[model samples]
Target: MAEWLNILLRSIGLFILVLLFARLMGKRQTSRMTFFDLITVIVIGVLTAAISLNLVNVLANGLIALAVWVFAPIGMYYLSIKSKMIRDIVQGRETVLVNHGKVLEDKLMEVRYTPEDLLSQLRKKNVFNFADVEFAIMEPSGEVSVLLKKDKQPITAKTLGVSVGHESVPQTVILDGVMMDEPLTAMGLNRQWLHTELEKIGVAPENVFIAQVDSAGQLYVDLFNDAIITPKPKTKDLLYVTLKKCQADCELYALGTKKKNAKKIYQESALELTEILDELEPLLKK
Candidate 1:
């Protein structure tokens, strides 16, 4: 009974020590383990078991051991933060795997990483070929950071000289065919307005896959079924179409004439585009 009590006490003490030790370490350190760190942890486990078996004085020995195990890392963390050299040695340094689109063979060998390993990490970031990378950095935590080549870099419509306004993450107004009341209220929208917008887009309320609202008060709707994704409409001549209408309504408008007037015209055209996008979105549900 006494031996069992000792074992139980030691087990609890050891767990408490490890928990405190881990909390003192950073999230990245715990998530990514190193050879030295793992060995040190194993030593702690062995000591914990030995103490538990009453090899050492149960109360005094276990308390001392637990205190050391808990506070040692906290001391090391202080040193690491104060000393740059210690920090680099403890956490390791970020290694450059590729510099200016060229792989550094010597650097790879020094870090004990292979071309295959680096390539695999790149693939995780959606880059398959070496030529597609401009720079690749191997962080000390075993994660890779990649920068793509100029030509391979993804270009949005804005980058391609297309006139696009600012974009932001859309707020979900409905999810899984259920109304999201909080989100709708946050966006100053309601279920009634949502239903009206869906009807305008020829989408039944039940058929909506997801309904999102942007800060610009535009509605984006997707369909639940995959068979009906029709491409969105593209205007061949937005300026000409809008200007002709604007001139008829108020003759004081041209594409570049009045700066503030041009902005208003642009906003109106953008609203129309968003409306058309809502109509076409239901077709591409798959």
Candidate 2:
């Protein structure tokens, strides 16, 4: 084979081989890679380059070395999974940077991270003041996990003792002016309902840039024309409110009516409507 053709063939074969080996090695994002992982990746790249450029005289020798590098970590990963001791040794234990609003100077030194480094990482996590941090630990991946003081933490529904409806993943029912039938059907909706929603909003499907239906059954739309502000549909909320009003009106009529039969009918109607509202509340509010 020609020199250039030989190099090209070698590169192509190695690329596919490495890709297969990489998948077998398992998936780990570059950002989340440990120091050990980074070194392994560098060595693999160097070996691949050497083999591709004919720096290694024996292709078989290069392949063996590549195999060792690729499989070693995979074995370690499995071992690590089965044993906590192996995992701690391989990945290294996370160092505590802060405990109960106090920065550990000794732990910082052990991790070879300065106070500024901790502050920088904390800032990235939206935590500016170290005093507010309840605990901060640097993981083996070098990412800092932060916990704020109880009082410093943001108030959630649970914290406030508020009863909130569950929210599922929002479905993208429309993308780039095209209706996505799968997502609509997944949400127990149809194209007819989508069309009706579009009509109610006074915007054509073609004009919509993107549309998503949240768990609350609210259709959120972004129009292609930014100049036009499309109003969000609150059909579920309106229906809920309308039902509540009707129930209230029925109760009022029951109290006001002089005839016993009319009063009994009104009371029964109100009670039935209240039951319906109770049943539908979960679906309406998310």
Candidate 3:
């Protein structure tokens, strides 16, 4: 009976220790879990359980040890934020993987990553060919950040040599089954205007999945019922056209690997964007 009781008490102590320690560590540390963090957690749990069955001051000692470990990271994080030196020590700086279509082998070695590993990360981003990548970065948190070759980049206003300011996201004036009064008022639209728009779209307020008005005064209406919604344009034709455009443009602007030029890959994307806009424009106008 005494042995059983001791086991029970130890189990309870282990559970409590893990709960408290886990809570102290932020969600990110646990969620994006690393090998070192997992091992540290296992060790703490085992140590707390072992001590729980021993001397009278076992609980107090365990708590104190847990507290020290818990706050130590917080203190380090605090110093890291305040001092550049400390920050470097805690979290290493970002490492560049590629520059100007050239692979930086030395940087890869510094990060202890092999060619296969780097390629694997790139493939995850849908970039299978190395020559297509102008820049790739492996952040300190083990996440990869990539910048495609200039020619592979989107034809944004700046890229097309056109000057344009920032574009704001559309405001949701109606959500679920209710109207957003604040957004309605801010956009110079009211309940009457919303009703008129819904009527034009052949959908009632109760039948809408979502409805919004953008800064350009374009109204986007999506209906909850498929029966009420207009039939969508054929995606197969649009997809083929878009893909061809992307491939062609990608080849023409081909900056990366010689195997697949920028013009050859993104040609289809151009056609698809144009087709999609044509279909959506009429719907919004209504």
Candidate 4:
């Protein structure tokens, strides 16, 4: 019974110690664990397990081993940042597998990677055709970063000489039916403005699951029951609404005016409405 109690207490203590050391190691070590980082984790696990099981009866020895494993990588990481040679040796430099659509056979053989392995990694990057790849680099963490040929890349606004204006990340103004006052205040918006925007989209404050305000001051609201009923207007629907308002105005001007040039003004409005409908027709087909 005393042996079982000892094991339990030691196990709990080691678990807490491991957790504390892991937190001190930082998030990058886990998320982007290199070959050296993996070795450090395995050694720590083995030492902790042996110590907890009383296989290594000296608690001080186990702790000393843990301290060395934990601090050594941290010290090396700092040194790696200071020295490029050490960084290259410790982290391993990125290897170019493919350059300008040509595979380096010698480099492939040196890395012990087969052509099939190269193709597999390329496919993972959504590049099935090797001819489309401008450069394929095997990063130190084993991730393949592929740069597609310029012609093969997706077209952007800049490519077409169009202005897209500045863009910024949308700020969350509300989450889970709760108003985030700090972000709303930071955005120079008050609860009254939020209420008005919610009303425009037919969403109540309490029913909103999440809400974000874009850089353009456009409020995007998602309600808890969105799957059943979407409160926001669709693109085509909004276009149709604008078209209807234009038609109503044209009729009002035609009826209310006694001037001779009133017909020309209504005709111009009708022409603009026709163009809007033409744009809406393609979206409606989708």
Off by over 4 Å in 1: 13-17, 32-59, 161-286
- TM-scores of the candidates are 0.55, 0.90, 0.61, 0.79
Query: What lDDT score belongs to each candidate, Candidate 1 first?
Result: 0.71, 0.90, 0.70, 0.84
Q: What are the per-residue Cα lDDT tens digits for candidate 1 across 1-286?
A: 6868868876787678667766765574567766446655676677767776767765687667756765675576579889989878766788899999999999899888888888889899999898989999988676889999888989975577554444566799877677788988888888898887776667776777787887555676677897877334223234345544544443333344568777687667656655654443332221
Best by TM-score: 2
Q: Summarize candidate 2's per-residue lDDT along 1-286 as a digit string, tens digits.
A: 8978888999999999998988887777255788778888999999999999989999999999998988998888889999999999777888889988889999999999988998999999999888899999999999999999999999986898656677799999999999999999999999999999899989999999999998877899999999999886788889999999999999999999999999999999999999998878867764
Off by over 4 Å in 4: 233-286
Cα deviation at 244, candidate 2, in Å, is: 2.8
Q: Where is model 3 more than 4 Å wrong at Cα?
A: 1-57, 230-286
lDDT of 1 at 15: 75
Tens-place lDDT digits, model 4, residues 1-286: 6988989999999999999999988898789877888888899999999989988878898789889999998899899999999999788889999999999999899788999999999999888899999999988887889999999998986798654446577889989999899888888899998998887767788898889987657777777885756554354456567777887788678777888698778867877777766655544423
True-vs-predicted CA distance for residue 207, candidate 4, Å: 1.5
| Alpha-carbon RMSD of each model | 8.3, 2.4, 14.5, 5.8
Candidate 1 RMSD computed on C-alpha atoms after optimal superposition onto the true structure: 8.3
Clash list (residue pairs), candidate 2? none
For model 2, what is the C-alpha lDDT against the true structure?
0.90
Clashes of 3: 31
